[model samples]
Target: MAKGWTFQSLIDEQMAVTAHCQTAPCHHRQVLDLVKLRDRFGPDAPAMEWDFKSKLKCSRCGGNKVGLIYTPDTSPTGYGKAKGG
Candidate 1:
């Protein structure tokens, strides 16, 4: 499902992604865009092609152990159901 997602891919596209904390009893998740990393995590945030997975953290758990899951652009992207019939 992740489709071998990597940092390079993120930098190259505006991917809808969810960052999940891997800490026990604290699976916090944050939905974000690839372009917002610098604004959210700061300009110095680590975005290495290989170490990308280790950069994300949960504000609730403060854990660096994170999981990056890919998400499809929905609603306006026409990938999700309309608001109403």
Candidate 2:
């Protein structure tokens, strides 16, 4: 886990967070809403903390073995490339 990565940090970086199910036979992934998370958990909530994982359950398999990933937005107007190469 990256140090000092709070929910606000992700928002500031315009990064998207996803929850991945690590349970065997259930590899489900879902993009999380940062605004909603920040609202629910507060902006200071630790983004990579284990306590956050305890609050999440895989919607597909109802499993607790979940992991988080932070990815920069890759839309044309977002963080990745420009309108054209």
Candidate 3:
């Protein structure tokens, strides 16, 4: 597992976090609010650490097998590249 990436890091980089349910028959996914998560877990909490998975639960299926996905926000106000260069 990589280290040094934290909730603050995600927020600073405008990364969108998503929670995905890995349990059988569920496979639910939801975009996470980085501010709320930073508040709950503190700004320094490990963002890419697998051990943090134990702290997550699926709201839809009520399962503990949760995984996190990090995506760079690509909206007009985000860090996406200009089109048709």
Candidate 4:
């Protein structure tokens, strides 16, 4: 696999998180789980995003708002901690 490529475990995690969500009357916990999983797995898992929107709908309640919050692109700044005030 290429660098940054998503593994099957990420997909499995998404599935487990969304299984119950597939049914109506979804729960919020499931959505949170999905967000966490996606964050842990990163934006490389295709299984997580394969719907009409070509995106991974939130696992909690199937809402698109449920996504991993992204931090600013700091790779160019080097892998160092920020300076203290």
Q: Largest TM-score belongs to which candidate?
A: 2
Superposing all C-alpha atoms, what RMSD in Å does each candidate have to the true structure?
5.5, 4.0, 4.5, 10.5
Write down the TM-score for model 3.
Answer: 0.78
lDDT top scorer: 2
Extract clashing residue pairs from model 2.
none
Regions of model 3 farther than 4 Å from truth: 1-3, 77-85
- Where does candidate 2 have its weakest 10-residue lDDT segment? 76-85
lDDT, candidate 1, 1-85, per-residue tens:
4344444465555456777888989998887666666566655555543457755567897888888776554447557657662
Report residue 26 deviation for candidate 1 (angstroms): 0.7
What lDDT score belongs to each candidate, Candidate 1 first? 0.64, 0.84, 0.83, 0.40
Which scores better on TM-score, 2 or 4?
2
Q: Residue by residue across 1-85, what tens digits does model 3's lDDT show?
A: 3446788998998888889999989999988888988899899888774847788899998999898887787677566758552
lDDT of 4 by residue, 31-85 (tens): 2244554575555554333221234464545665432331222333565776554
In candidate 1, stretches whose alpha carbon ends up further than 4 angstroms from where it belongs are 1-14, 38-50, 76-85
Query: Lowest-scoring 10 consecutive residues by lDDT in candidate 3?
Result: 76-85
Better of 1 and 4 by lDDT: 1
Candidate 2 regions with alpha-carbon error over 4 angstroms: 77-85
Where in model 4 is the C-alpha error above 4 Å?
1-17, 21-32, 48-85
Output the lDDT of residue 83, model 4.
Answer: 55
